[model samples]
Target: MWAAAKEYFTHPQMESFKRDVINHMRGLWRTWRSKMNCEHVKNHDNLEDILNDVPEFLIKEDWEWLVKEKFLCKEFKKMSKTNEENRALKTMNQHSGRRPVRQIALDLEEKLGRPPTVAELVFKTYKEGDMIKDDAANERHAKILEIMESNPDFTALEVVEAILGEQKRGHVICFGGGLRPKDLKSSTSTKDATDANLEAQLRRSDEEKEALHQSVIELKGTVSEQAEEMATMKAEMKKLQEMFASSQNRQH
Candidate 1:
């Protein structure tokens, strides 16, 4: 895959791009499956017929599994009900339509002198015609205003948490990039701990390497000193033998 690419990318960049692609594909798959459920699975009693009418893109076995195992499951039904309730809470249409809130926020940041607050961005996007869509939104807007006025330094995330409290797992209150605060916090803490562990391991490895290097140097010095001492002892023994031989010759 790296060879196939015309341009070079760092490993981290490649990994990030891969994640983005996988996320996009998953999103597409979910959207397609949801539409299929709405069209074929919901309000349809004939499973065999639905299986027969399976789209060309899906295998018959996969379609059967979806119809029999997934759509018919109790958990799926309960989740569907919960999703419907959540959908009902969306009282206003977003002016930005299908565009992500982050993009809208970026544009707002350019337009305003500084970055716009979440409340300001929400009010700008969540509108119908010329006015606020409903009383619920109006009340939320008022509360956000009150909070911001009281605490001028609070960030968008902070404001959201203040207004809506902690979000449930797998749920975001306001299109806040699909991350629950509690989950994000836990993930961040875990990542930090893992990184710290890796750093400690690397430090220990380096220390061990340095200690081994020092030991090798000391061993070499000891061997050299022992060799020099042995050479001096051999010279002294040779001198003693010569002196003994010379004395024996004189006595003869």
Candidate 2:
């Protein structure tokens, strides 16, 4: 429980509340042994772990304080299982038949006359529905992210254009400026040398297509000329045949 609490304490979202929770708990943790009338944690052996250790059993007063301060969250965060260890833990759970804790958190912040939390930014972003609904489009987006991660030079705009069609370009992305991954951040200048490789590819493909179209038009003109020459040749052959028949009739 203490380990989980420590993890939650370090989480990045809603830092205002989380920091206060940590500071308040720090006092409790510091005086835990004295408060509990106990000098040991985990069989009186783990002495190093004693520093800033939460008591195994919290007392009534502790519970009351947490409640009075509105620090105890009703919905437990489930980011412990996620592999995304570097990012902030999302506090809002999308469960059915439950009041929106996110809204409550926002309201509480407003009531307290505090600024919007990092958690609020996250909630608003999700509310905007940045995720692509189609599984295939999502898979393609993931692949694009992977490619960007590997390359590291591509800006978010380039990545978006590569991953999304023209219609879906702006909709495919919704990351913040600073918090976004290195690949997704649109820095004005990245390192030199094949920067516009994707753009070059698109331009080259278009050029090739135009050339192919021109070749097709030239081929059609050549075919028309061949057909006209064949028609003239057949007319000349008929005239020769008619002249021979007329000569034969005169001889008869």
Candidate 3:
């Protein structure tokens, strides 16, 4: 049994397996740690802790070997794991129920102190498969239109929820404005406009920064040149003063 285990651990394939297992374990530990009120752990610190905690699961000799072969330190591995988890968590949170179509619209209205338009709502929730008929998402499109006509202030996200909630036949309703190619084109154009505006603002800012930097450089150069000129003037004035004193002494 010892020989078999040792052989498996030494095998090249086992290196991949070890990485998968360690990564999974690290993920679980992070989740557990987050739920707790402990201070955030640094990568190296976390790896050291993991090594201490799971010495049996991750044989120290094998781990050291993997680290040497992979040219990755324990801390680096821990940092990589932490980064992956952070990204996954961010994605999960962003797609969470908080951003439902209806809710997003309502929030926008509340913030803007006005109702949103149907086109705006349609543009927000018009994912490719969202308009398709399924038992889970039926008659959503028609409902969105109905809601928009009825509630000018309602967000597109809100309209989607209302339609989905009221659906009975599991029939697909392509949101009239949402499923249209023109609507998509409009949305794309809107995004392009926004991007252009942002790019213009960034360019202006960069120009300002460059101008400021140049001004600072010029000021420094001018100050340095003035200092040198002042020094030369002072030396020449001292030499003239000495010559005048020497001539006066000679005449006396």
Candidate 4:
């Protein structure tokens, strides 16, 4: 309550923070799984070896909750599908001749390198962020969350990929390119390119601003120097003219 009062986590900021938590937990799960065949380690002995590497982002109690909540996911083969994912894929499939939009979405997931939209929805509940309220997609996201609870190692991207498989070429062009640029917003590679361009542009702008500021400072100094020189010359010329007039009067 106090943290919310302090505005420590704005809505978007909280979402960003929670995304990190998902990334961290997913990483820990992958590390744990990697030891399945290591001769020096016992995979089934306990989760202790893996849990020990928990990052500072989570406390001891948080770790346990995450284990129960995000880790120990259900069997991949038996897991249920996400409604949000299903709906998204179905929408795509409807556009194409394909019977299952999920397959095409998974194919895109692999090729496009993005998580299923449904999986993104599930992260909200797992992180308990500011956007944890229920909506049309909540039920579907909940199913995915339950699966994650049991099979923590399976990432949202992987879950979608498993059903979609590696062959992207054969799938129907379901979810055809967005009618405009806004549709391309979800593409990670595209977003990365755009972000890079924006960053470079911002850097150049800053540099230009600094250069202009320095030039103004230099011009001010130059103007002051010129004014002093002009005043001195004027005074000397006036004295010379007066002296010449005095000499002429003496000659007369």
lDDT of 4 by residue, 137-158 (tens): 4554555556656655553333
Residues 209-241, model 2: lDDT tens digits: 665677678789999999999999999999999
TM-score between candidate 1 and the true structure: 0.58
lDDT scores in order? 0.63, 0.44, 0.47, 0.45
lDDT assessment of candidate 4:
0.45
Q: What lDDT does candidate 1 reach at residue 52? A: 77
- For candidate 3, report its TM-score: 0.27
Checking candidate 3 for backbone clashes, the offending pairs are 101-157, 101-158, 102-157, 102-158, 141-175
Question: What TM-score quantifies how close candidate 4 is to the native fold?
Answer: 0.26
Off by over 4 Å in 3: 1-192
TM-score of model 2 (CA atoms): 0.26
lDDT of 3 by residue, 87-176 (tens): 775311112133544354455456766544544444444434544334232344455557767765553334444544432232112232
RMSD of each: 20.0, 29.5, 21.0, 21.2
Most lDDT-accurate candidate: 1
Global lDDT of model 1: 0.63
